[model samples]
Target: MERTLSSELNTQQVSSKSAMPLRLLANLLQWQRRMASRHQLARLDSRLLADAGISEAQRFSELNKPFWR
Candidate 1:
């Protein structure tokens, strides 16, 4: 009975530890998606800037600013 309890506790600890990596993987995936979106937006912004006669350097400078502003 004692051994069984010990094994159960060990299993629980291992599962909890494994969950951390899964959470980290989820976070990494989320970050990757956000980065992809930002890249697409930057590409679109560059095109728009070109249409507006803005230089590439100026577009990059403006891109450094927050999107909401």
Candidate 2:
């Protein structure tokens, strides 16, 4: 019974360890997507920005932000 418990704990630890890299990858992907969207937002014309209900000030704010934010 004690050996079984130890093996289970070890398995849990291994799984959690493996999850760290996946989490980092997910975060990086999200940041990359944010960067791309910001780039597109920067290219928007006044008409398109008005259609999207975004003001020039809002677009400027978003464009100036860091990708990680």
Lowest summed lDDT window (length 10), candidate 1: 60-69
- Candidate 2 differs from the real structure by a C-alpha RMSD in angstroms, to one decimal, of 1.9
Q: Which stretches of candidate 2 lie above 4 Å from their native place?
A: 1-3
Candidate 1: residue 45 Cα off by (Å): 4.6
Clashing pairs in 1: none
TM-score of 2: 0.86
RMSD to native, candidate 1: 7.4
Please state the error at residue 26 of candidate 1 in Å: 1.2
- The candidate scoring highest on lDDT is 2
Query: What does candidate 1's lDDT look like per residue over 1-69, in tens digits?
Result: 457888999999999999999998888887677666556646776667677787877656755754333
Q: Each candidate's TM vs. the true structure?
A: 0.49, 0.86
Model 2, range 10-69, lDDT digits (tens) per residue?
A: 999999999999999999999999999999998899999999999999998999898999
